[model samples]
Target chain A: MIETKNLRFSYNGMEVLKGVDFKGEKGEFIGILGPNGAGKTTFLRCLAGILDCRGVFVRGKPLNEYSPRDLARIVAYVPQRVEPSFLTVFDTVLLGRRPYMGLTPSDSDIKTVEEALKRLGIEHLSLKRTNEISGGELQKVSIARALAQEPQILLMDEPTNNLDLRSQLEVMRLARELANDGKTVVTVMHDVNLALRFAKRFLFMKDGKKMADGGLEVLNERLFEEVYGVKVEIGEIGGVLVVVPI
Target chain B: MPMDYEAYTRRKAFIGLILFLSLLVVSLFSLSSGPYHVPLREVLGILFGGGTKDDRLVVLSIRLPRIVAGILVGASMGIAGAVLQGYLRNPLATPFTMGVSNGSMFGASLAIILGAGYSLNSGQVFLNNPYAVVLFAFLGAISATLVILALARLRGLSPEAIVLAGVAMSSLYVALTTLVQYFANEVQLSAMIYWSFGNLARATWRENAIMGVSFILVFFYFILKRWDLNASTLGDDIAKSVGVNIERERLVGTLLSAFITSVTVAFVGVIGFIGLIAPHSMRLIAGGDYRSLIPLSALAGALLLVSADTMARLIVSPMNLPVGVITSFLGAPTFIYLLVKMEGRR
Candidate 1:
């Protein structure tokens, strides 16, 4: 569904993504794991085409060729944190359909937003202002908004960051279900255990390079130490893979 | 949850419709209640070319121009304020905040101190000629806008950067205006003082025509871009994520807003608080949606200014108090009430 070949990005004369190569397919939940400054977020942003970079493609078309409106229909990106706004949840989610909407939202757009809210179990919070909601509910609202875009690929930057335990699990479960429903879901995560439990594929990045890329087999003590400079033990809990630092 | 977004939209439309009707009634009332005391029947007749010569002179030749000019100025200032506030995502953002008013004030002061030949014998100074104060004020306002845009471009067009640059420019212009005030003689001083206070009495049929045309052109531009303004309130990157061409929209929106403000200020002097107060008031009455907010703010602004001008005309009978003075008195209390209401909500 998405591909990048030798993608390079720099900021202030410093190369943050040094010729990185990555690829993804439909119905895949990929977790990007690395330590601080490992270029995970930058790589995600490049894939989302927010940064001007060459060699990034979506469905075999070059990223640069797509207008912002067309590109929004193909990929939805959720930042690490969104500032609370005065708009209600429904209104904020409806903003996701901006690319498809006219001056006012069409019936289809409104229906899509409603479905997204219900999917996230946030239908009750639709009328409340976004600022009046909890951080966890806000995360769900952000996800609901992204879903409202109906994009083929979803990119999230540390969506579970600052979320409570239940909210974190719920979001991961939703991502897993989205992948099951044949959408490409890529997320940058710090919680390796959560990533291991939910994600079907993993990419470990270190110092602006991909250190490992595979299934559960790539997740080992050596890979953890190489990417994060830490030792970890891997086990199975309730038939799900779990990673814990020892 | 099958929420009724349509119902909310309908409610907003109803509120907007009511406000428009109120503005219509207020405008007719203002047209009828001048010193000449043209009756409502005669006012309607004059509008349709059926009234006596005396009633026609009062309604069509004199009162109609001022009323139309007041509406144009109010609507333009209100829309400009709403656009700037939404674009910059700051409640305090207005045309005046961009230093355009101060820049125009400085230019008017310069013309007052230097061009003394245009003063009337009745102790009132008017920028009646296009070659004198009006021309200088236009140049000053346009130049200020261009300079602010250039500085904002240098800093990645951050809202804070633009606002801070505007504040600096505003202070410098104020200091310059004060310096001009210090050097003025009695006639020039009164001219400068009255220009700063903002009077709607100087508007004639010609000026009203120009203002009306400008208001229509710019008002439609804002209406077309209202959705973009809503997207912008979500922050720069997020707005971009939603397919909004942030840089292009910001540039065009700010330039248009500044242009509207320059035209109004060039004609009517620095009418403070209308731009600052009208949009905020509209936001409170309506929701944050820009589609409804823009038109509603325009009507509410016309209503506020027309009502205030009518009151100014009534409080002292024949001698017209500057409409700016009335707006300040009315706007400050409403502004304080809004601030308190906002605090209570939070």
Candidate 2:
């Protein structure tokens, strides 16, 4: 399990994650919904052990106590943007096996990378350079690289940004399946409809603070106005709650 | 359509083998094609100890030491450039472009003006206190690394920022070298200017041994960090998530690269463009997978330098145009061709 207690992060004096508190249980799927500059990414980074902020604890220990490799074995982070380079997709995904292998990748490492590419449906692009792939394929490649790590907890920041609609649905489904398979999955998302449809729990953040946290009970007309600063109509569409801006 | 990955890796391995074989051929050709020319078969005979005394003297005493120097300097700069490009993720990043050479120039210049009492008479440069110049040049190169490392650690500068810092540092070192040259008399100034024109003949067996050791150690270190280097090319966030201590690797990588380059430059003076050209050419041919790029770039560097130094010795026949001038002359056009090819592909 991962949790943060009153986490606050300042970027050269201006606070981004101001006293944000959160926790995730095993097998929980959490969709962190927020507007721009709402500290969602910063809070996710803290959980991934990339940020050296106080109050982030994993598995009953403080974040700093674990070695980098140990933390990596437990948590994987997919950033908002994955830079394209000269590496082939297979080689890029093979980088995830780094913490476990020594000198050169072993057979198991190769198998794991192949499995990851297969799972992400990028096996066809294995030998192609990342720079040559389309944006949506690149997003899948990034997720496949993260998945190659086989982390128990996955943290994604806007993983579906460059993805098309079908790819976005596939990613959400994968996240949902990972949570169902007893891995903790947390994603910071801007699309509320997709989040509401696939993720069971939601945490709405605004101005570097958590404004709401719960299941469907947190949804209401006033909540959208408060969180996104826009009026919206909330209704049930085929048993899933839908929010339409009015 | 799916590409065959196993075949792709096999192709890269084949390319690497070809590069290694070519390096061998270049080395032998270098051994035979000097002013006191020995035939290739005779060169092989000399290698097996059956050549005439005069042939042995020319091959063993006059040519072998400088040829060995070329191999060491070229391979050193090549590996340095490859790893620096990997770490900084900047296409233009190399030990030369990162201000190490400029810093060495400043240090050599300072050593000259501050009483090394070097003299250049009728275009033949001589340094009385060569060791002092070497020491100061090494110190100057390391100082540039220290400043950049400090900024990266303290200020958390991005790769782009670090490259820009190198540019800024290079300009500063160039200006400082010019100022120091301004204070020197005719002999000292000319000595410094000639020193900056990389001469392979300056290295003897002792310098070659030192350079050989540094190159071996650094090459193994980078080989060990191949996976980390691969991770780094994807950017820092992904690298850290994949359990690489990116900052530590960056520091060690930059320091070791600078150390080897400083040793080479201090011994042989500044050999430009080998670092930039060798790695990029390999990347274009074999991709940026450090596993192959590391050793391949080193071999390519050696082959390139051996070829260039041979041409330098033979171009004017007994008047060796500085190998640095040859590298720039040849490197500029090849680099432009690569650039245009890359753009055309894009």
Candidate 3:
């Protein structure tokens, strides 16, 4: 299980994450919903140990207890977008195995990379340059890189931002598959319906604080209006709850 | 969509590069032939078997040392350029861009103005060198590196910050070098100016041996760290997530690049553009895989400088022009052409 207690972060004397508490059990898929500047990325960075925050604890250990490499081995982070000017897809995926390989990669490393690429359906693009590929393909490549690390916890920040309809569905399906495989998956998503459909649990953030954290039934029009500061219509479709702006 | 053609082309390109490097080594020996009229048989005899005293002296003492120096300097600059470019993730990034060359020039010019250049005229000075040219040059290079690195830290050491800092430091060093030139006497100024233009006529077997060993060792280190370089271009966050210690890698990489640049500039005066252009050309040909690009850049760099030095000697006959002048003359037009072509393609 991955848990954060009273995580607080500030940038240039301005608070971005204010005493946030979050938890994710094994095999749980959690979706984070937030507006612009709502501290979604910051919270994820704090969880990934990429940012030093106050009052943060993970797995009964302080954040500082684990080195960057050790944290990376436990949590695999996929950023929103990565535009590398020089690297092949295969090479980018191979970098995910760095913590495991000291000097050179072994045969098992290559097999893991191949399997990750195959799982992401980007095996054909393995030889192409990262910059030359399309945005959706790059997103898949980034996710593939994270998956290749074989971490128990996966953190993604708006991973489906630039993807098309089919690509978005593919990504969500993959996320669901990963969660089914017993990985704790935490993803930041903008689409409310997609999040409700894919994530068993959801956390809503507003003004750098957690507004609500519960199951799909806990999200209603009044709660959405209060959290987003805007009127929204909430309804059920095919047993999945969704919110739309009014 | 097809794999066959790309595989074939890649194989052919690799074979071609190997053949070209071999031919370049042969051309280095052939450079002994011009106006001096050294026979091919005598050159070969001196190279393999012991030959006449005069043949051995000419081949072993003069031509061989110069050729070896050219190869080593070329390889050093090439490898340093590749490493810097990879670290900065910018096509224009180079050791010279960080003010290493201009700083070395200023250090060398200061030594010359202080009469240190002449202090090493005893013929055995190479063995017991007390003049401060090399020491000052190394200090200048390291200080410039520190300045650029410090400025880069202001914006979190992003690639853009590093490049901008390099540009600023380069301009500052150029101004300092100009100031040194203004205070020098006529003879000292001429000597300093010539040294700044670069020459390889002072190559000794001992220096070549030192340079060769350092180049090979550092080159292997770069090869080993190629994966870290590859990951870094993806950005600091991603690189960290992939288990790379970004700060440590950058620190080690910058230090190694500065060390190689200092050693080369200490021996051969300031040779510009080789470190900038060689890596870019290698990237274009080899497709940006540092594992392949680093070694290929080294070979291409060595070949280019050796050929340029040979042409510098033959283009002006006995008056041998500065190798730096020749490289700039050749490199500038090619660089402009590449810029235009890249723009057009875009």
Prediction RMSDs, each to the true structure? 2.3, 1.6, 3.5
Q: Residue B135 lDDT in model 1?
A: 74
Interface RMSD of each: 1.8, 1.4, 2.8
Q: Write model 2 residue lDDT over A137-245, tens digit each, in one string.
A: 9889889998999998999998889888998999999999999999999999999999989898999999899999988888888988999999999888888778899
TM-score top scorer: 2
Model 3: pairs clashing at backbone N, Cα or C within 3 Å: none
Model 3: lDDT equals 0.78
What TM-score does candidate 2 reach? 0.97
Residue B268 CA displacement from its true place in model 2, Å:
0.6
Worst 10 residues of 1 chain B by lDDT: B123-132
Query: What 10-residue stretch in candidate 3 chain B is worst by lDDT?
Result: B119-128
What is the descending lDDT order? 2, 1, 3
**For model 3 chain A, the run of ten residues with the poorest summed lDDT:** A54-63
Per-candidate clashes, comma-separated: 0, 0, 0
Over B304-346, each residue of candidate 1 has an lDDT whose tens digit, in order, gives 8888888888789877888998998888888888867655443
| TM-score result, candidate 3 | 0.91
Report lDDT per candidate.
0.83, 0.88, 0.78
> How does model 2 score on DockQ?
0.73
